[model samples]
Target chain A: MSLDNEQVQHIALLARLRLADDELGETVEKLSRIVDFVDQLAAAPTDDVVPMAHPLNAVQRLRPDAVTEPDDRDHLQQNAAAVSDGLYLVPKVIE
Target chain B: MKGQWEVVIGLEIHTQLATVSKIFSGAATAYGAAPNTQACLVDLGYPGTLPVLNREVVRMAAMFGLAVNATIAPRSVFARKNYFYPDLPKGYQISQYELPIVAGGELFIAGDDGAQKRIGITRAHLEEDAGKSIHEGFDRQSGIDLNRAGTPLLEIVSEPDLRSAREAVAYMRKIHSIVRYLGISDGNMQEGSFRCDANVSVRPRGQEKLGTRAELKNLNSFRFVERAINFEIERQIDVLEDGGEVVQETRLYDADRDETRSMRSKEEANDYRYFPDPDLLPVEIDAAWVEELRSALPELPDAKRERFVAQYELKPDDAEILTASRALADYYEAAVSAGSGAPQAVGNWVIGDLTGALNRDGLDIAESKVAAEQLAGLVDRIADNTISGKIAKEVFDAMWAGEGSADEIIAARGLKQITDTSAIEAIVDKVIAANPGQVAEYQAGKDKLIGFFVGQVMKETQGKANPGVVNQMLKAKLAG
Candidate 1:
């Protein structure tokens, strides 16, 4: 499948990315190439092969369900751009 | 409503697992923590962070699968569902996609007609919760609380087997009780421990193909789910009747307005590019572990209900109510075992008086002030004729008020039954003498006046007179 400029713009909007007027052409080219490269694998005849999820084919490691982390709001919130009442503040989000 | 259209409903219930920590992080999962206080570095999705699966979450998911008799996949994989929201700092949620932990189970719920209907469960998968975006607490800005982020959740999806809003609620309630009985969730709808999204659609009668479905999101209560489904069903039917196509979208249930409105159209749907998370591995459960967990499972509600009917000779309805909650079932058994030899009597008190009082006080059986032994004592007093059933209720009220034991309350208030023949005879004589006109009417074959004399004797003895003795003495006196 080929990606069009409109499709690329829609993807950008979904990703919450702001692109300059000049950046759109280059972005569409790069994303189309990536899509084409991935689409190439559709031609590989491997109907009987089992799909692999992980490279190492390893199962999940389990952790005990105990509260091992302590309350560190004061320290952790230091990374936030803005925080009030212990909550990270962002621009108003409509429903 | 019945013959014009048919409603097709499916439910996706998100049950927060009763885990101490988040699914992927070691952050505390306790509710009511200060904003962001329980969130840790791992939960914040800091760079170079990895998610480790919580074994308890997997165990809980497996437990639910077993509870519903679903197939537990020996191996399950976690995937990242990519999306963008301020509350989701990771820009994606860690959830199961292609391979979920549980698959293909059925829950039997009572239909509107009281017959059992089986609802198929499509899958139940483990996932990490998203944070809360507080849209109202700030001016021109929203607050993001990560406290709920990364919390363990088991999202159980059901096939569209429900036919009406009532059936959907029944199915939700059945799931709710099962999770609570498994001790896998607190099932607190108020706290969002158990929440569900309802997918609703409508079809013309005799139509085999399903109509377009509108998903109602985040209905946290049973009543809301039912009402939302009903409203959605009616809206769809109306739209179709007016030659309009029902649009597939996500809707929100405005419980205050008792209506559902479109939140987002299908055109605006997010394309969640789901892919296997390379950070986490596929979970593999050995048969030995499954067997061990199965053996440790408690007696489920159905089996307990059957046993109650078979062993205690309780009515099926009574047994159903008693076994609705594991704690109540255990309380009933304890009361019976605590020397309340009359099983039926004990079941009655537990189901009738005890449950009534508990509900009136907005308390659970575990939080009930009346202990099992105390209830047993009350039941035993009635069985042994120490106190009439009516007086036992008064004693029960006293016990609930923390007055004392059944014996203590009876002794303190002199509420014991006037089982002594002479004592009852004296009250009977006083009642007969006080109501001469009624007595004369009774002697003239006004047999219905026997009730009036019995009431007089009961009132004189403070409802402690042995009713049988009072009747016998009154009949003998009036007959002479």
Candidate 2:
């Protein structure tokens, strides 16, 4: 499938990415190629096989309900640019 | 004003599961912790962290599925709901999409005509809750508390079967009661453990097609759910009558203003881009495990109500009220066991007096000042004819005041009933002799004077005479 500039811009907007006019054409072309490559697998002839979520056949492991983690907020928030009273701060989002 | 129109409502209730830890991490799930003290690396969506399934959450979902008669999937998948928000550190939420753990069930609520109404449950799925974002006292920024993030939530979706606000409240309340009864969630709306979103719309009464709906968000209480839906219904009708088309959107319920306004920020964010989460494999719950949870299930409300009717021989209304909560039902049964084996009498004290005192004092059954055995003692005294029912009220009030046991109070107050035949007869003779004019009127066929004689006997005995025995002896003395 071929790509259009408008669709690419919409996807970028949804992903919170700002693409300049010069970057839009190349991004559209690359995304179109990725979509086409993924679309090729739709032609496979395995009619009875169930769709799988992962490559491995192992099932998800369950953990017993227990609290083992200690207070690590101070250490975890060290990488953030801003924090107050142990809360991570960000630009205000409207309700 | 909407006699020609019909309202349709469906609800999505998100109940936080009561777990000791987060859904996929070992972080504590306790509420009201400091902003980030309880958050772990996994909850923050840190690098190289993989989400694991919690055994209790899966069991909780299965118990709910069985309780509602839903189909528990043999295998369920988790999908990533992609969105951009600060509260969601990963920019996506782990939720069940195509194949949820529970699907296709119905819960019965009392309809408008006082009959059982089955509201269809579309599906219930497991999801991770988002963090809390505090906008107040922040300079051009919002403070994000990640403690609530990754906490387990069961989002129950219902079909658009509700017809009115009252019915909606009843349906939501039924779900709340079931979750609490199952011991899965605390169902505390004030603490944000249970909340609902309502999809409301209206159309002509005979129209089969549903009108465009506006989703009302953040209805944290039963009253808010009702008021939000009502306001949205009226707003839609007004729009349609004014030749305006209803726009499908998300609206915030302004509880203070009693109105709903379109949330402009969420207007264009409907594309969730859902896909299977690669970090987690499919969760497979076999039949044996499902059966184990089923066998371990507690007695639900419907079964308890039925047993109350058959075992206790209680009226349906009384049974319903007594079984409204597990604690009340347990209290009633314990009282009956400790009392004179009179189920109906014990049930009456529980449903009438105990419930009234609890409400008047702003307390719950669990917080009642009177204990079950103490109440039983009072009922036993009344049954053994040691104290009249009238005097038992005073005893009960004294009990509520923490005076002492029923026996002690009765003895200290000198309020024992005069059940002895000769004792009651002597009081009756004294009353008859003292009120000769009224006795003549009574013997002259003014039969209503019997109440006067009974009153005099009670007054002379200090309201301690058995009214039944007093009536019999007074009638015999007045006749001959």
Please write out the lDDT profile of model 1 over residues B184-289, one tens digit for every residue.
Answer: 9999999999999998998987899999999999699988988888888888988988899998889999999999988863464468879898898789998998
- Identify the runs in model 1 with alpha carbons over 4 angstroms from their true place: A19-22, B265-267, B440-447
Question: How does each model score on TM-score?
Answer: 0.95, 0.92
lDDT of 1 at A24: 86
- In model 2, the clashing pairs are none
Q: What DockQ does every candidate get? A: 0.78, 0.82
Which model scores highest in TM-score? 1
lDDT of 1 at B61: 94
lDDT (10s digit) by residue, model 2, range B315-393: 9989987887788888998898888788888888887788899999999788999999999999999899899889999
DockQ result, candidate 2: 0.82
Q: Once model 1 is optimally superposed onto the true structure by TM-score, how far is the C-alpha of residue B377 displaced, in angstroms?
A: 0.9
Give model 2's clash tally: 0
List model 2 lDDT by residue over A6-66, tens digit each: 8889888889899999998899999999989988898998799987766777888999999
Q: For candidate 1, lDDT tens digit of each residue in A46-71?
A: 89998775677767789998888899
